[model samples]
Target: MLSNDWAIEARGLVKRFDGFTAVDGVDLSVPQGAIYGILGPNGAGKTTTLRMLQGIIDPDSGVRRILGADRPHDVAHRIGYLPEERGLYPTMKTYEAIAFMGALRGLPLAEGRRRGKAMMEEHGLSYAIDRQIRQLSKGMAQQVQILGTLVHNPDLVIFDEPFSGLDALNQGKLEKMIRALAAGGTTVIFSTHVIAHAERLCDEVAIIAGGRVPFAGPVDVARDRIPAQVRLETRHADGPWRAALPPDARHEGALWSFPLPDTGVEPLLRALIEGEAGILSLSIERAGLHDAFVAIAGEAAARALGQPTQEEAA
Candidate 1:
């Protein structure tokens, strides 16, 4: 049975295509009003899993519940989805496009139009209000589609690669919009190959790789899996305190870098000062989600993430 506190829940979900496993057994739990991120590299079955969750495609096996409904159809009108592929009616005016999108979700055309124009004004897109979608820039067009997705003010919103193809400025705009949504008590779920975005916005996340989830919990928990690192720069390379440093400690000139000492940094700091090593700088850094992903998902997945996307390559 699904819990009332959860907006989404899935268990042992599996999906296969043409004898190839696209998504292996997967599990997820999303709180009622959180910004949850599905983090993974390309070809990691993110889209497939999302499709199954949306009831766009049935899983080969397993079960899921969306907004307390076993059948997503019962609450389809209450959810908004922005697919990886973007499209809109090019001939329609910007506000009309947004209104049309809302209409599809049960808003009246007149009410949708009124709300759409108000939204455009609020977002500084009022100048494009009367302009046709085809006349807008690619980024502007995408913004229209994004506005359309939220025009109905759905309780749950799913965005697949929402940041993909957006320039840095526009990407920031989208991030602000997502934050506003969460502040308004909406549940926002998004998938991205970039871990940084998830680290910044998500309250909780599920790290997926090779179609399976290896870790799912608070962002801090994911990062805390690896010990904090220490960067030490000292005048003297050799000292009695050197014994406190790990064998794998990296040295370049006067700077040294390694994981924090098992006995803790205080003992080492005390020894370094007493042993007469002139400390120039010392800083400890906890592992970030990017580092956690590499540690949890492995280097092969990291390579896939580092590869430039088509937009970047262009």
Candidate 2:
């Protein structure tokens, strides 16, 4: 037994295939009822790590205790998983598909159907409850799959890239759903390449790149790894106050930007005032997850941050 407080505990998990290491000594701990995120770019081993955790694929090495069990499948009945590669019988009615999924998790078919019908009605999808999967819109199909994943009411929920293929509106709905899940004390673990979603939703996160975890912990902690950034707009760009700026500071026209000084901003503020440097505006912003990822994952990993993934391109 895992003391009931931790939903998952994994240590030094490793998986390799055909001489290529897919996950290299990954470790993760998820507290019960917390919203945790695995963050990385596409092909960064996010899916592999999630698969290992789900026990869908065994790791070449390492151990895991999931939902108080030594093996993942031992507690499978208490977990809900939605994989990135989604599939549902195209001919199956929406409600039947949800009931089928629940049945796989040991829910009785009748109860599953009842819950499925109520859930669809609650989500304002009653019209699609009887429609076949083929006839529903893409977003609607995805929604049905999500409902299926939850039909059994699993305590631990894992969604691998749930936001992929969702438009802005649907994405917002999904975010709201995740929040509701967490609010109701469900332990939610999800993987995503999108930084904004992770930054906004995750209380804790693991940053992965090239099949390796570069940093893992609280989101604020990861962001604090880099000093806060400072942007300054002034009437005059150069003065004795400029000397107070960090050596790496750069300027374009009247705007200067740099990392905040370790000595704090008081000295710089005083210098600007005493030197009569006209400070038009000054702002300090803590480093976001994007900046922290770049700093931790290095240039090679950072290159992928700007490139649109295949899902976005499509």
Candidate 3:
């Protein structure tokens, strides 16, 4: 039985557009206050999943529970969503836009304005609060949108490519804010093609391909799927005994690869000593989440969506 304490739960969720399936069967569970991440290339159905979770679009099949409530049915008040595409009234003042979003989430107009001003000051937007969104820089505009997303203080927050358009400094700032939100007991489900940000910010992650999850778990568990391989260079090129070892060693040219069971250097060290192959250089190689994503999901997924293994839009 799944705990009622979970912020988001889905069982075999499915979504379709006309005759085509946009999101295939998917099972996801997000614990309360987790910084969960959905990673995929373009058209992987991440946005569709978020839309369903937020009740913007109903699912064609399966189950979805977000923020302790069934979506597209009841309780739109407990969720905050930041879409992949930016949307802000060009003529609206930054503070007004944010407060308006808060009001939509059920906060009173006066309280929403107070919170909006506080967030603006907290995020270094105090100077731009009165300015029209059209006059702000792209980075500042993005910040305004983020403030709007959080103004309601929803229990569940969904961010689709939150870092789409921003400088390095702004991206870093957003990352910090995301971490802070999770720490403050907000269940944050964010989708990104950027692998580094996911690796850094997420407690758990789901990697989607072809609109389905192929990998979902902790980062270390995902990393464990790929074995470690080391490349060793010998001092001599044409030494005798180019034969293979019982441990399955391969040699090409002067380069030798003695696949160790893991990162332990002792076995490889002993093998080199026994082989009488003079060692030139030895380096330990561990596969990163990016390599695992490519190896598991294949090159097509990588080609279709060229994003960092953790952070795509960023």
After TM-score superposition, the amount by which residue 57's alpha carbon in candidate 2 deviates from its true location, in angstroms, is 1.5
Regions of model 3 farther than 4 Å from truth: 1-5, 71-75, 233-259, 262-265, 278-281, 307-314
Give me the overall lDDT of model 2: 0.88
lDDT of 3: 0.80
Off by over 4 Å in 1: 307-314
Name the best candidate (by lDDT).
Answer: 1
Give a tens-digit lDDT track for model 1, residues 1-314. 55656899999899999998989999999998899999888889899998898899999998999999889888888999999999998899999999999998899999999999999999999888999999999888988899999999999999999998889999999999999999999999999987778989999999898999998889999998888999999988897878778899989999998898778989989988988888999999998888888888877777787834323432
- Model 3 agreement with the true structure over 1-314: per-residue lDDT tens digits: 33466788887779987788889998788889899999888899999988887778878888787766764446677788889889888999888889888888888888888888889998877998789989999888888988988988888888999978888899999999888889898889999888788878888888888879888877777777777767888876644334323357667877766555553778657766677778888776766777777766767787676744323422
What is the RMSD, in Å, between candidate 2 and the native fold over all Cα? 3.3
TM-scores of all candidate predictions against the true structure = 0.95, 0.94, 0.87
Error of 2 at 138 (Å): 2.0
C-alpha lDDT of candidate 1 relative to the true structure: 0.90
Kindly list the per-residue Cα lDDT of model 2 for residues 1-314, writing each as its tens digit.
Answer: 23445898888889999999999999888988999999887889999999998899999998888988877888888999999999999999999999999999999999999999999999889988889999998889999999999999999999999998889998998999999999999999999878899989999999899888878889999999999888999888677777777889878899888888888989889988887789999999898787787778865676675633323432
Q: What is the C-alpha lDDT of each candidate?
A: 0.90, 0.88, 0.80
